[model samples]
Target chain A: MIRFDNVTKRYAGGHEGVSEICLEVDAGELVFLTGHSGAGKTTLLKLLALIERPTRGQVLLNGRNVGRLPARAIPEHRRGLGMVFQDHKLLPDRTVFENVSLPLIIAGLGRREIARRVRAALDQVGLLSRESSRPDALSTGEQQRVGIARAVVGRPRLLIADEPTGNLDPDLSLEIMMLFRRLNGVGVTMLIATHDLALVQELGGRRVILEGGRVSGEQD
Target chain B: MRLWLTRHVQNCLAAMGRLVQRPAGSLLTIAVIGIALALPAGLNVLVRNGEVLAGGWESARDFSVYLKPGEELAQAATLAKSLSANSNVDDVEIISAEAALADFQQSGSFEGALTGLDNNPLPHTLVVRPRPEAPASELAELARELGKDTSVDQVRLDTEWVERLNAILEFVRRGIWLAAGLLAIAVVVIVGNTIRLDIENRRAEIEVAKLLGATDAFVRRPFLYTGFWYGLGGGLFALVVVLVGLAVLGGPVARLSALYGASFQLQGLAGSGALTVLGGGLVAGLVGAWFAVSQHLTAIQPKI
Candidate 1:
């Protein structure tokens, strides 16, 4: 469902965030990006979300060239994909339910439908009991799960994450990884960026390795 | 359609909730907006009151034509008859020189001073009251024409005070409009700055919202509602200020009018006037919020 043809993103001051990155992942396929810090993993994901544009070459999503999406169309492009962050990105002031329901609210879903879908997503993430609790009250792992619940509440077919397990302990990280595997079992495509090679092997997915802002290797 | 309404309702409530959460800042911003809005509204109401007070005396369109000394009472009588025949002239009362002297001498000190005179020096005077419906220019033209007559030495309009008062009122009215326009800009700036600070404080929330597939409009809805509330609140507060001012001044104004030989009631804002002040505040608030969000929202992309 995704393709990048030699995409290059060069920041100002001649620093390359990502360069000459040609990649592809088939629909419903789960792929892990393995790299150290500043290896351009986040930049690659950002290109897909149109958060940052490629300085050269084409980036295609499904069959459409999305590298040059007009400013007005960026939101619609993003709405089709679920995104999770390492920081959880939950509003501390709001209830966990409100955090998860944000995407549906943006999509203009009815209030009842929002409640139903939010409950279902929360149930999936094992956060069903903490819906009314604010993010600060939830454990770090629970907060990450809340983020995952939010990402999936819209029922988007594609999901992307930038180091989703970066902040959790190994036990919690394994639980979150299993959660991703469980989601993949049901036909959701995912591109996850991470630095844990052993866990990448444990998850048993195709791993694309990045080094010095370029894709260095691929292993199945 | 229902979903749209529900979403908007939620957004408005959320905006209000945010404002309520930060009571001190919100109240300060609102107080500034209220005072800004009240300045122009209060001034406009005062101008209305001035117009009402001025209304009493502007209609005094009377004048006196003093005939030349040595003019016979018969000549003055004939002059008054001709003036009365003019369509603009409502009525003219002829005061013979002998009658003028006797009326003047009846007043105490003036009689003592004029006892040395062998003959009455007061000239024959014609007190002319013009038609009430006569336009100002028409009345001035009639006075000029009367002064040109050889029988008349001077044509003195008693309503000159009214003209001077009208000029001062018009000037003040213009000044109020200029001040209102300036203060309108001030209101917009105040709101814009407040919204900008609000956006900065909620920067993380905005980044998260945008990352979660929220559009600019989706992210902006709350701020817009905040502005809407600010404007609506400011407008309401301005109405309060105006009413309070009217109440405080009402008694003194009535007494002042009484001293002037008239009983005047102070009129507060009419319905339309209140609406106008409210509407202006709403527009300014919305505009300020729009500019603030448009300029700053895009600058805050979720940095990877």
Candidate 2:
């Protein structure tokens, strides 16, 4: 479902975010992307999400060159993939239900369908009772759960999470990782970027390691 | 089809709810717009009333032609008859010197003022009324033509005040247009600033929405609707202000007209006029909102 052919992204100051990175992940595959700070893990995921364009070479998703996607098609393209950020990115002013309903709302879903899907997503995240509570009022883990619920609520075929467990304690982090494993067991493809090698080892997933601006190794 | 309508209605309601949530700020903006609209509308009513009053003085457009001293009454009568037959002349009345003296005597206040004269001092005069549709310039031309006649000493038209009134009315009309235009721009600026602040306050929410796949148009919908509501409310308020102004002036205007032996009524806005005011408000609001959102929304993309 994803392929990168010698993709290179360079910043304005001549710093290389990622260089000549060639990678592929088949459909329905769950993979971990591990790297140290500034190792281009976030930049790599951003390229796949079409949030940033590759400075060279081609980035393909579902057999289509994403770098050539028109500006008007960006939202439509994004709607097909769920994305999670380390900060949760939940709207502080919105309730948990509203936060989760954002994706379906953008898709122009009917109110009844949005409500139904939002409740189910919240239920999956185990925050069904806090649906009406504002994100700021929720605990850090709960807010992260709301963010996950938002991402999966759209039923996207691919989920790209950038350090989803970065802000959580080890216990909560494990719980969140277990949640990702359960989602993967149900055949939802996921590519998670993290620096936690021990957690990757514990989860026992295929790992793609980045060092400096290049993919250093791959392990299964 | 129903779903589209439902979403639009929901968006409109949501916009209204946001305005209502901050009632004081919204009300102040609306009141400013209302006052701006009312000024021009009230001036327009004054212009209308001036036109009506000018129409009532149409008969005063006639000319009084005074024949040269020693001209015969018979000559004046013949002149009046000839003027009456002219296509431009509606009618002509001839007043002999005897009749003029008799009119002056009947006024009582001027009873003996003219008695010392051995003969009547007043000359034979012909009052010439032009066609009712005659323009002031055309009537002035006719007056100049009459002055060329050897038998006439002077031709005096009582239309000077009417001309001055018309000039004043024109000046006022242009002033009203200028005021209206400036106020419209003010409305746009006011609404644009308000929308800008709203966007700023909701910056984080907007960024989150965009990240969640919301299009620029989808994000802009609520702010546009907010502008719509503001314009609508402002227009209605302006209409009320104008109507109440007319009502307050109506009684005094009627009394003044009665003193002049005339009946006059203040005219309020008809159905179409009210609609126009409301429509103007809506358009200004929509345009202002569009400008604000388009400028600020692009700058608010999620940083990723």
Candidate 3:
């Protein structure tokens, strides 16, 4: 569950990242955030991730005020929600398995347990065969799937992704979208930000559109 | 507990792997630390050898108490017995004036010159050997006490060389400690600089780890272990340097001592001294790594 009631974030140079925004999503829902460039989608996701705080009003997660969370508690909060970035953010020096195992490792799982969960998550992302292959050897879509596997390895209830398919071809993007649909079928709440309007139309999910740092419209 | 220990083991191995990835750089850093530590270690060993050689010469320090001319031989013998009873005095022997004159006549080429004299000019003397462990100050005190006797003319103690050697040794010991302190700071600095560069090179990896919800402590663990390895290697290498130095000097020293008609052996650091060197290196490495990690890790949060 999530709630953002009239939250505004302003940068130090007097640039408003998001202004007087209001949004909410019930549990077990998959929502797509779409807008043009500088539409404040990334800023909204950052507030949810606690990477940036709202300048005014409040951002809540399951009725808890995350805008008020202290710096020391940010790590634990981030760990509770899985995050996927547009660039995949995979360590190029490590193998795909090692990259995916990172979240479970941070959670301090035992070696056997970590191995088991990493294999299962990689299987879900169709990256099981490329476990020992380094990220540099993988294609763009596979790298993004590796990132998805890493985010979901710890079985977080809520997942937030920023431009997950921004680097993929149309066919690869549709494959990745199907992967998200499968995850949502398993009751993992998903909030994905993207500007891919065609994919949004094809997916036929609840959509929130942002324009100039404000929620301009919504479609069901 | 099991998971925590497992993570530590993983981090330690990971650190070792990273070091091995750049073997030349790691070994060079270790060697610098070894030589830096070896300077003080070698100096300490040499000082100890000097003390041993001085200790051999120290036992000969003694006192010569001269009785007044024409003093009775019997009174001189009684003075020797009383002086021997003091706790500080190890032994005392009285030499009668007649015996002294005869010995002087045989040892010197002045027998004919001495026979021309009507009477023996030598006075009864007591040879006093103080306890081996007695300090120079205590020896001086005993000599002063002997001079207070009515039959005693002059008390002469041969302790100048002993006092001078002790003072020199004290000065060298303090100098070595000062050098050791400054060099210790150098070791810490060397390790800190190494770790700082390591953090810089791994900036991207650190950012990814932090974004994956890795705590600062988790990011710091591997760097600390790398420091630990560097310190440990340097410590062992320093001990090796000292041992080899002692070995090279040992043969020439023994030959020199043989030329002097004395058999002296070169001594290296004892167990406790070696332990101190190793412990100092380890602590320095850990502290240096800690400073670098704390200063640099906080500045490297995920910027997205």
Candidate 4:
């Protein structure tokens, strides 16, 4: 479903963010990306999200080279993938329901379909009752749950969570991981980038660890 | 394209909702824009009103011919009748010297001065009212034509006042254009600066939207709509300001016109001028929004 061939990303001022990385993930596979801070884990996720272009080589998704794709085609490629952030990033002014319905709205879904899908997504995250509440009015955990609901609401084939549990306590982090596991059980491809070694060992999925902008180890 | 427009409109509405959620800030912005727009609009009203007053003043005077004192009354009367029948003249009133002397005697202030006269000192006069469609230069030519007659002493054209009034109107018109130009520039800068501030404040949200595959147009639409509302609301406020100003000063204007013996009407924004005021506001808003969007949208991206 995704592939990278000798992809290199360099920021200005001679800083090498990611270099000579080659990797692939099969369909419906759950993968954990573990790396220390500034080890290019975020860079890899950004490259896959089409937010940053690789300086060299190519990044491919669904058999099309995204790095070689025209800038205009980047959005179309991103629509197929779901992304969650360390910060919930919920629109503070919007109700939880509205935030969750964003992707479907962007997709031009009708009002009825959006309502139905959003309700289902909220139900899956146990946030159906809090749909009318704004993000600021909710607890941090609930807000993160709303973020999760929004990410999955569009039913994207691939879900990327970049440090999704970064700001949460251990119990809350495990709860979010359980939510991810629940999502993965339903055949949604999941890639989680985190530095939590204990959590990774507990989840026991395929792990790819990065060291110094390169993939240093992997274990099933 | 349809989908894009639909979403864009929704995003605009959303932005407006957020703006309204903070009423004080919205009001402040609207007031600023309104004041700027109203300056030009109010000046335009003054220019139009000046033109109307000048037009009325020009319409008052007619062609006057002073006849030679020795000319026979019968001959002078015949000439007046002929001139009255001409296609160019609407009316001709013959004022004989005797009648002119009597009109001077009727006023008690001049009665004693005129009582000592042996023969009527006033010259026989012919007053000519030109056709409504006659041009000013044509009327001057007509006056020159009347001056060549053997029985006529002098032909005084009523055109000098018209020329002077036209000069004043031209001055006011130029002033209006200058004021409008300056005000328009002010509006663009004000709106642009406001939108730029808004873009900076919402930089995070814009970055997130772009990262989610939203296009520049998509991200920019909300801000543009915000600017549009600013313009539209400001325009409406400006219209209100102009009308209120006219209403407050209406009595004074009427009094001033009455003092000058003119039944002048001060016109408010009507027809095309109203459209222009509204359009000006809208254009300012759109342009300001465009500047901010073009400047900020491309520079933001997800974390490096």
Candidate 5:
């Protein structure tokens, strides 16, 4: 469902962030992208999310070159993809339910559908009882789950999580990973970028490792 | 379609709810903006009143042909007849020296002096009222034509007062425009700065929304609504301020008019002026959001 052909992203001052990185993910497959800081993992996820353009390569999703899509069309393209972040970037001003309902709202879903989907997503994250609670009231792990619920509430074809468990304890990290595994079993293509080698090794999914701005290893 | 409407309505309500969450801050912001908008709105009302005051001058298109001492009544009568025959002259009133003296005596201030006079020194005058609303240039031309008649010693238009009043009105008109222009700039800056602060405070929310597949529009909708409410509240407050000012000044205005023995009403904003104020406020809010969105929204990215 996702492919990259010689994708190169060079930052300003001629710094190569991601150099000629080529990779592919089949439908409903789960992959872990393991890399240290500044190893092009974030850049690859950003490229697939259409947040940044590849400098000298094609990034395709659903067999279409998303790198070539016009800026105005980027929003529509993003509708098919879900993304979660390390910061647990839930809006503190919004209630947990509101944060989760945001993606459905963006997709122009009916209010009844948004409510139904948001309740279901919150239920999945074990946050149904905390729907009316603001993000400020939630713990870090709970906030991150809110972010995850928001990402999946739109029922996107692909889900990308960037350091999804970075701030969590081992137990919470494992639980989050288990949530992703369950989601993948339900046919959502998943790509997780993380520093937790032990967890990825334990899960035994396809692995793509990055080093010096290039994909150094791939294994299944 | 119905779904989209429902979501947008919810979004708008959600936006309004967020604004209400900080009620004190919102009220203070609205007060600041209202003060800015009220100055221009108040000045607009004065400008409209000035127009009405000038409307009388617009219609007072008349000239008086005053005869010299020793000029015979026959000569004044002939001149009056000739002036009345002119197409530009709407009507002429012949004021003989005897009749002029009688008018002077009727005024109490000059009654004692008139009683002691041996003979009336007042000259025979032909009061000429011109056709409806003559331009200044046309009146000047008519005066020149009347001055050429030897039977008349001078043609006194009494337009000097009109000219001075027009100059003052012109100054006030230009002053209103300057005030309105400066206030508009102030409005934009006020709203722009407010929106900038909001963007800063909600930076995390914006990034979160972007990660959740929320487009620029979806993220911007609430901020835009915030600006709009600010403007709407400010505009309504401004209108109230103007009305209150008019009410406070109304007594003095009425008293002055009574002293002058003339009827005058202080004019307030009518249809177009009110609409302009409301629309201008909305536009200012929208433009302010535009500046903030263009500057800050692009800096946020969906990240690792």
Candidate 6:
């Protein structure tokens, strides 16, 4: 579960990245966040990950105020959620398996279990056969799939994605959305930020739209 | 517990692999550290050998008490007997002026010049050997006490040169230690600069790791291990350099001491000394890595 109460983030030059946002997503819920390039979607997700603290108000994840979490506790708090970025964020030097196993490795999982879960997650993303291949060797779609596998390998309760299919073709984007659908059906909560309104409608999840760093509208 | 061990082991191996990947750069850094460490280590060996030479001289603490020019052999013999009765005086031998003159003429290279003197000008001398364990200060005190006697003109203790040699050796010992300390700081700076460069090179990887929930400790582990390996390699190389230096100088040093009628041999680093060298390397490496990581790691934030 995630909750935001009047959260605001302001940069040093007095530019408000996000301001006074009140929102919530319950357990096992799939939500879509839609906004333009500078609409502060990334900032909201960063707040959830505790990457940047809210300048005002509280961010609660699983009933814990993440905005007030101690600096030392940020990593532990982040470990409970999985994050995927638009750029795929996979270490180019490492193989698909290593990239996927990063989260599990961070959690200090045993080798056998990491291998098993990585295989299962890769299978779900349809990149299981590309485990030993480096990210540079994969297509844009395949690289995104590898990122997804990495996000889910640690079995985090919440999955957050910033433009998960930004670099993919329409067909690949649909395929990736279907993968998220399947994951949502299996009781994994997710918050996805995307500019593709058509895909957002097609996927048929609750949509929260942002405009100029504020929540403009929500559609059920 | 098992998980912690497994992660640390993997971190160490991964760190080693990184160093091996760039062998030339790593070896160059290690060589710099080794040369720095070897300077002091070599000096230490030299100081130890000097101590050995000085120790040999100190063991023979003998003094010569010369009688006044007009003093007779009977007075000198009587003083020798009295000195021999003292607890600190191990032995005393009376050498009359006639015997001293004859002995000097037999072996002295200036024998013809010395034989031209009108009369035997040498005074009766009492050779006093102090107790085996007597300190130099105590022997000087004895010599001073003998000089105050009515029959004695000059009291000479052989310990003066030995004392001066000891002082020089002590000064060298302190200099070596100071050099060692300064070089140790140099080692830390060298290792620190190397680690800082390493952290910069891996900046992207570290950001990604932190984004994926890796703690500062987890991200720090590999770099720290890298520093450790660098230090270890440098320490081993330093030992090799010092040993090789000793090997090259060993024969020459022995022969030089032999010319002085001493069978002195250079001693290499013992087991504990080697451990200390290695330990110093480890500490320097770890400290340098820690400083680099703490300074640079915090500046890099995952900009989501």
Q: Return the clash pairs for model 5, or none.
A: none
- Give every prediction's interface RMSD: 1.0, 1.1, 1.0, 2.3, 1.9, 0.9
lDDT of 4 at A180: 94
In candidate 5, stretches whose alpha carbon ends up further than 4 angstroms from where it belongs are B1-8, B50-62, B67-88, B95-124
lDDT tens string, model 4, A44-76?
A: 998888777899988988888888788877766
Candidates in order have lDDT scores of 0.89, 0.89, 0.91, 0.84, 0.84, 0.89
Q: What ranges in model 2 sit over 4 Å off?
A: B66-134, B150-154, B255-262
Any runs in candidate 3 off by more than 4 Å, and if so which? B72-124, B130-138, B141-145
- Please give the lDDT score at residue A8 for candidate 1: 95
Q: List TM-scores of chain B, every candidate.
A: 0.79, 0.82, 0.86, 0.81, 0.83, 0.80
Model 6 compared with the native: what TM-score?
Answer: 0.90
For model 1, what is the alpha-carbon lDDT of residue B171?
96
Sort all candidates by DockQ, best to worst: 6, 3, 1, 2, 5, 4
Cα lDDT for residue A118, model 2?
Answer: 97
Model 3, residue B92: displacement in angstroms?
A: 4.5
Computed on C-alphas against the true complex, the DockQ of each candidate is: 0.68, 0.63, 0.70, 0.43, 0.59, 0.75
TM-scores of chain A in all candidate models? 0.98, 0.98, 0.99, 0.97, 0.98, 0.98
Flag clash pairs in model 2.
none
**Residue range with the least summed lDDT across 10 consecutive positions in model 6 chain B:** B52-61
Report the Cα lDDT for residue B41, model 3.
89
TM-score-wise, the better of 1 and 3 is 3
Residue B291 of model 1, lDDT score: 86
Worst lDDT run of 10 residues, candidate 6 chain A, spans A74-83
